[model samples]
Target: MPASSHHYRRTVLLLWLAAAVLLGLTWWHVFALVSQSRAKELANAERDLANLTRVSQEHANRTFRGADQVIRFIQSRYLELGNTLDLKALTLQGVIDAEIFPQVGVIDAMGIYTLSNQPITGKLDLSDREHFKVHVTSTSDALFVSQPVLGRATGKWSIQLTRRINRPNGDFAGVVVVSVDPGYFTRFYKELRLGQRGMMALYGLDGVARALNVGSREEFGRQANNSPVFARIAAGEEEGHYTARSVVDNVDQMVHFRKLPGYSLMIAAGLDTQSVLGNHNAAKEALWLQAAIVSMLVLALATALTRHLRQIGTEMNTRQRAQRQIEERNAQLNAIFDLSPDGFVSFDNKKRVNYISPAFRQMTGMGNETLEGVDENDFSIWLAWRCATSTPFLGVAALRADLAGGKPDPRVLIELNQRGKRVLQLGLRSSKSSSVSQILYLRDVTHEAEVDQMKSEFLATAAHELRTPMASILGYAEVLLNEEFNAATQHEFLNTIYVQSKLMANILNELLDLARIEARRDRDFRYTRVDLQMLVTDLAHTYPVPAGRSGLELTLPEQPLYLMADSGKLRQTLLNVISNAFKYSPHGDPVELKAWIKSTPNRAPGVCIEITDHGIGMSPAQLARVGERFYRADTSGKIPGTGLGMSIVKEIVALHHGTIEIDSAPGLGTTVRLCLPTYATLQDSVDQDGPSRSKLDHAIQDTRPAALS
Candidate 1:
């Protein structure tokens, strides 16, 4: 057998041995606990039974003695008046109570008749009564208590108590009897609350139950001569306990009995065994339940250990397989990390560099030098030098303060010149899952920042443009209100006011159009088919040319070239281009418009329109920004043109999936080109790059577009 299998068997045996030992100990504990519980319960029950017995006897003594005392008082009256006793008058005067003693009378020697507390209607004799027979047999001073019997006078079941009545010669005369209701003793005992199936019984010296209250019933005429419980008390036992069933109710119980000290009566209290030991049994059952639960937990732990041991070999094999796969992929990940375009670097909470990307190296001009030992202070020195050598808009001190300040903006943009003009956006992000606390990144945003600057300049230029026209309108209106002029001069001033007011209104309307189209949230354009030949011919004929300045020339293809576009916006775009051509050209130069259909590689067949002006044109620098909002080539307030016209033209062409081109120089002229797709579906004009390119190109291509110039 293999050593591994032998080891497995040994380990399994050890686990089971441990479990068996633990189970044995648990069972021992449970048995000891249960035994202790049983002993305590028995001791408590015996003590409680003794207390109950004492209480029952005291209750029986007080009631019986009270009745005996009443009988003695009645006997004194009988001895006084011999045969002519007025028992009815004594009872009527509240001297003798019929409720306590239902019948108090005396029997003659012949046992023929009797005198009672209440008058008897019929002939009631007492010669056969147990109390009368006892006195005739023994002429003693002791009271004879008999078992419950129906009274001859009252006809109610009662315990008969009699004392001997002797004549002057000391012979047996008769018996003075008292009928004691047994309910008083039984009801008193019932209040003692001996638990379920309890009893309080009174037994005579003759071993007969005189007054008994057993399980809620009162009865008599029962003999206890053969009872083991009674035999104990009869054989000179003072007090004792035994387990037996009641003779009156037959309920199984533990009976506790005590003989009255000076009387021949014995009172016993019995309680069901279940009531006495039920709590102890419950504690034993709870111990058993705990043992069962511990056993289940042990078995479950064993099963888990076995399963874990079996999986060890498989897990080892899996770990080796995963290690090889990680090794194979490590090189590819490193290559990507070095080549990423965005600069990346990490720093710990103490400002130690954890990692630095190659792009970050190039940006900081640390050519081919390893950054492994570089700390944040080293990078800070490099950053300080870069800020000094480059643009100083926000100085090195300001940038350094933010880096070391209590708190700083997470992202900050800096305008600088490195290899070329550049805008570096620096940002910090937290990394929680490493020793490194922060990662700092830098991205080149030169083109975006320059465009943003141009927009800002454009906004200022627009405000100036709007205010210039308002100033003219307000000047002419104030002059007209105050100064008197000839009819022709006033008319000229009014014309100037009208033209300036119209210029302001047109600028405001154009700004509104730009805002609506750029929103892109809803349908911005109503698409329709347009005929280029008709559009160009109409624009040429009704051209807004100055009277003695220029000619509007049209060069259109004879065949109608139709394109799918928003006609209203397209018309506005074309008119803006034409108007700018006339507005910017030298006073007598001709503004020419031409249109034709042209097709390009990977693009749909589209209409091309070129507006060329033979005027003093823009420099290369000015031409670059000609398509910006509110940008103007002429800033001297000489040319009658708002810079927004070309930008609007560019936006409208781009919306129709078209492009704009401008070719110009410092002193020559400028030509604007628009190449638009013809009436085909919008998707036909879209360009999708195939897989025949670098992966980076597919992800984020930096392409510079030129219109058909």
Candidate 2:
């Protein structure tokens, strides 16, 4: 060998010896440090285990006491409401009100079960549970707490506590059970400060751990029970931490298990042995790192891990608190809107409905049909329903106006048809501050409008009736008392005075009859079977035509008009029209009376009366204003008359279920047509009370007549 090679070999040998010696010393020191650390860890773990055991026992005791208290409370409630608990007579709502927990229920021995706020009421059997059997058989007053199990009704995991109740005869009176979720208990575990790679688990007597961190719960339960520490706890012998092979990673782990008091359950906590003997691990890594820079970063790794753990904890607490606040606010808002008086609706940014208040459903008469996730235009069900019940309420218009216009300051009104007789009014207003909702208000104003119109008509009829008769009586009395006439003239004057007095009397009688009819409000027409042709003939003969009249013609149809009607009102209506024409134009032109029966297309048969006269016809303006009470047109400068003629005629025609129409022009003749519904019986009139005839009558009654002369 070369001298250089021989020298390098010696050097290598010495370096190898130094390296081996340093590694051995480092290993021994780290071993000693780890032994001390382990001894201290065991002492600390024992103390922690004892504390945990005491805490767990206290927790279990408190929970047991709480459950017992709940049972006592339930027993008191049951006794207090014993009369209400009769299985055969209990109502669903009553039971719901009587329930102690909003999320739980009770089943009596009679098989009657009561769930809180539920709409179901009936008998139910609960003899199928193992826990119930235990509860019934146990001689102690202590509650029998069942292991965590899945609920059949809600499919949720829960732990049940059952206690038997005794009757007056010392017989079993069924059991009161309280169920709580294990997850609720799991929330307490989050406060445990386990080191890196540390974990805790809870296992039931069924050999199933309800929860685990990284491994399958089933596998953990199966293998963990076989572990030395778990075995010690199962036998009720373990008191402190001990080293064992981990069920998941096959590495050594320091573990502790505590048995739950008076229950077939256990809680286990475990930490990785590598993490527990951290000094030894650090020393082993340090030697290797002296030769490699990668291992030298161990200290930095520990620092980073600590920081990350703290950050994660802080974030979790923040998120949990925020979630709680959000839940509380949401609940409060729901209560406010649900009980609000106005109809309320909320929409999302996409214009999809999100919420609707109870008032909305009550006002619009909607049920169960979801408005959420539906396009505003697709809400035709509400639209059609609103149109049927009240005025149609138009929805908020467009997104551009709602979003870009600063707010949802929108208003709309819609008219609705109700049964083809009444129209309703609905008003909708969108919130000015919120773009997400709109409010609707519906009002039934039909009766209000009727009342207003009746008031106006009553005042008008009273004034006209009172003034017309008083004016005629005063005028005729003045002419008679003044004696402004000779023998021949006096005769004419006296005759004129007599006619005026009779007209006055007729006006007063019409007013009195109208008032009586209104006070009775009886629509029942006293029908009498009579010869219709004779009635028409007598009416025509009763017409007071002037002597030496100007070719006045009276024409009637050559047929017997046999009909059932309120003959008195019908006769009054006919006479009012005939007398009006004569009083307006007695000498200017001949009067013509025509009668016929005609049935137009899609109409019932009715008698038609037309009275026309070639007289001083009224101008359109004068005719338009004539129907108004005491309203005399300016064209009739010297006319002596009461304006009640047309008004009375309109009222009489309406009561008889007939219609009146007038046609006239300036310097032309005037024609008045009246169509009286000729029903065959009183029943026919009652059934035909549809607005078709009333609408026609209303229009005719609103029409103006010629100015009096």
Candidate 3:
């Protein structure tokens, strides 16, 4: 070959070699990235499984604790009342949640199944049952959870939670067993919506499965001794995660297992190995495709460079394309900052604002304000002006001084008076990156602050209300105990103490009722079709009239108005309103209650109950604060009330999907109207196939006075 041709051949060889090296490096990077991605996916799956296992373990522990409480309660009651415990009545009265523990029974000392919340068909001997035998032989009061067994009394598959019941002298009386349905755990697991091959199981330390749900299949009393989790437990591992084939179905999975802290049971949650890696596998394939494209582009670039040895224009175009890609990435980052809910402000190295996220502008109520390139100190002054005078902000000077003094950036909460008031948690941090000097973050915390304030106020009001009655009770009791008095004087003091005690009890009860209503949100209420006319009449007749007062006067429409409501709660609401009417009107004015069918354009047709009381009516301000807790319109010492009655009434009415309107003046008396959806209107709103519709249908078919009442 000629010298020039030899030189060209050598240069081409070097170019091909460089392209080969680049392709190899590209593949290596892709493989490393895919490997890391796979590891991350597995780690995340294990973390999720561990968290699910922890939740299941907690649920099981809570269930066991609740069952033990019921057992202890029954044991004490049974020991005191003996055969007169009335388990069935207690169950009916909701002293025990029968839905959770379907059967609670007492086995006599002779091993006879004597009493139970569930019906007993015949004399059933439970002597051979492990739950019964364990308690009978061992005097220990430790709760014993038995393997799932077919109950003789209830004729259902249940796990027996039993405790040994002893007499007052510590003599063994019998066993108190609470039967829990294993399906309960499985049902709850279904709600977790684990993948089709997911598994959740509650197993005893002895390796018996109390409840196991694999996808949709449920099993109990299955032996899992050969499982890997059991081996780990045997090796003293309380909790762990491992990938292994399941002994039950031979499906490979990543299993996270945890042992209940104080119980013998263990909970395990498993995600199918293939399902867990599904996303990672897809990503790996995409990464390989991208690597192949990059390799092709690298080879093409090498060939182009070898052919066009002196091409400067091609190099410039390549640089321009790379610049465009960088700009695109920057735009993406900017989009993310703009979309973030938390406000962010970045200052350039000069400490002047370079970027302000949309969220930051909205948080500061500075809409359309040109804040870019503004000095940090000037921005701080503007923010200070926006903040409430009550909570002034520490300006940028203080923040910089702290940072210059080697202190951490200050995080402060500032309240803004603009835009209907707001609380912002402000945090500042110095950035080490060359592009920015500092970053400011603002988070809206107004809701949290409001909640804290409401809680504090409620607690303070409760304490003050309880303290007044408590002081009266303590003073009278002390006087009676220490000083001798005549029989009449002693009786009067005793009466005073009794009244004060009752007042305190009423306050506590009303507070608890309010809390329950708020927490449960009417889940505990039993809904039924109630006759509005009949209910009002019953209230009028049953109300305890004061000495100088006439009973409530009733006005009812000719046709009966029916409503879908929890009758007990509705009755409580009406009683509260009527009682308030009488309590405020000490002059014996008869409260008039009128019921009629009402309709509104914005709502469904409903029934309205208007109760008008000629009482010491409230002013506009007091009426505005009517439903506020512990707010009484009459603050005079003559009235007797906890002031929580209206609050409870409001909550109950709202739970029924009803509205209440109160109209009053200083002397014109007050008219309170309760508008509740009619049964027919509510039935129309309910789904056709829903249980509520069926219940409403059944109620409609049965119109007897007994059913209505």
Candidate 4:
């Protein structure tokens, strides 16, 4: 082989060896992690199974113990009744007369049905019943439970409990049986759950599942004397697990079984294996996906490495023959670096600055001749400058590091004041060559900050000035209305003053409210349970008097409603709406106040208060801009008021955690609707403290609203 081909073969071999080693290491690490994770999951599953088994056994014991106690209590009562048979019959007769007989009927030791307080009367054969049969056959005086059977007298599905009795000669004489309606068992297991897709059933001594198995009644009377579960129980096992197909859904399930304490019955709770192992199946799928990805990545990386080695081999073979070409290429690269707009530098492993272009010094505000001997690691001067100027250079360093790790980050815009009042934006990058150096380009952005500052200062001054006079005017009007004055002389003047004052106040408040909201300050919330009906009635009474004075009618509902909300805020919202109605409508136009609860689909219950006025209503275009601060519908200035009532209403409603909607027509009428949540109690209305009084209101002139004359 030629010398070049020999070197090429050696390079290929090294690449292959490295790829193989890396692939094996990666596979081992991933496999070990997956295996350890799966083992922990399996252990946790086994522990959960053990806990479930213990819980099921305890539940079964409690149920059986309760049943046993009920049987014993009935047996003792029956024995006592036997001694006073006459009195027992009298009480049974009285119960039947009263038409509230007991659910169960008791029998005496003589096998005679002494008391049948139930409405269904019949002489029944005690020997034929399973409860009586179990009692008579047993040698001991133990409580015996029988298989579920149809009662011959009532024809209802029932289970029976019985007590054995003996005659004076010590020979078995008869039995006392207490019939239990199977409905009791149905109710007992109705709420019991094994899992999302699991159910429970009770099994008897005869291997037959009982009525407790919900919705499997057809198989009740069928013989089940040879089930695997019953066979194990008969072998004296207290508990076991069996894989069986459920009769209800015909799905295979793992049934956990427990024998009831001192009872022949057993509880079988089943969980579908597919359902129980859902999360495990999901995890396994994820692992398989990861393994496939790992294999593909390994193949891709190996191919890339092979290609890279081939390229390096080609370069090495031509190195001796192209010495002049390599020098020329290096000169061209140096020229490009020096002429570039951004800072550029190359550092060797020892952290010494190997190469830096003029652009680097220019961008960093450094002298060009002094950079060559400087250590790149000693960058504290640059960091300190960044901190002093509040320039975002530390973030630039982090951004460059992230870019090196194959992350896509945006060019950062930094504000820097380096030796002048100029701001700079830096664009940083790490070379793809895997060399230990970073590149950066920076520019200025001082004009943007000046523009933003102008906007903030304008809003603050304008809002403060407008609000001061508005509060003074509104507050004085309120004081005049509240004081006892000469009614005939000053009423009209005061009313006019109040109306104009309200309009001015609303404009000022909206401007201030919007300004504060834009500043993102904390909102004030007050909770109070207001009788919604009372509020509506008061508003209606006020609206009609004003409307009547202007030759108009006001309509309202005749009932009371209640809701939880900030009353002051709600009043402000209402005042704006009522003011709007009076302002836009022609004198004598009817206004309607309606309050009702709206039941919204897929939303919380809402209480709505609506004000409607019939006058020269607004166009759709005007209504759309109604909530904009200082937004005027009619610029003709014929309307003698500031156009901020609706806007203030919108803000106040928002502060009260309510929503407002407007409906209007050019020639018909306008309606405003406010929906708020109904407070269930006083606690629901307010936060931990009661309604908070506004400190801002105290600082400003008190703008108390005047009551309607």
Give me the candidate number with maximum lDDT.
3
Question: lDDT per residue, candidate 4, 1-709, as tens digits?
Answer: 8999999999888877877775666556446645654554444444444445455456555544545554455455455445343323434545222122123455555455654434446666566566766665677767776677887766776666666765556667466555655555544555554455565666677766664443333234434465577778878888777667766566676677777776777766666667666665675566556555655665667755445444434653464355433221000000001123555565544444566667556655677455454554455245345433455456544665667675433365555456655455555544545454555455444455554575566456556546755666666577676876677646765666666566655555556555554444224545555666666556655654553445223344333344556676677677777767776775667666777666555555567777888877789788777875556666675766555567667766665567888888987888888887653222233334442234222322322221111
Model 3 spans with C-alpha error above 4 angstroms: 1-342, 352-386, 392-398, 405-407, 679-709
Cα lDDT tens digits, model 1, 180-235, are 88876777777877755777788887788877777677777678777787668657
Model 1: ten consecutive residues of lowest lDDT: 328-337
**lDDT of candidate 2 over 1-709, digit per residue (tens):** 9999999999877665655554454445445544654565455554554554445444544555656666665655565454343322222434322222223445565434453223344445556665567656665445666655666554666667667666666666666666655554444454555554655666664555654433222222234445665566656663556777876557676667677766666666666666655754564455344323312222234223334434434654674476445321000000001122456566555556777777667545567767877755665345655574444444445433553465322334444453344333444445544556544444545455655686678677666656655676677678778767678876776677677666666555655555555444326445443345576678766666767665446787554443445667667766767766766675657678787765665566676778897667788877886556545443343565556667767666665567788898866768998876654322233234332444333322322121111
Go through the candidates in order and give each one's C-alpha lDDT: 0.71, 0.56, 0.82, 0.57
Most TM-score-accurate candidate: 3
TM-scores of all predicted structures: 0.41, 0.34, 0.48, 0.36
Worst 10 residues of 4 by lDDT: 328-337
Q: Could you give candidate 3's per-residue lDDT for residues 146-177 as a string of tens digits?
A: 99998888778999999998877888899999
Model 4 spans > 4 angstroms off: 1-60, 83-102, 107-117, 168-173, 181-190, 211-227, 234-236, 240-250, 302-709
TM-score of 3: 0.48
Total clashing residue pairs per candidate?
0, 4, 0, 8
Q: What's the lDDT for residue 39 in model 3?
A: 86
Least well predicted 10-residue stretch by lDDT in candidate 2: 328-337
RMSD of 2: 43.6
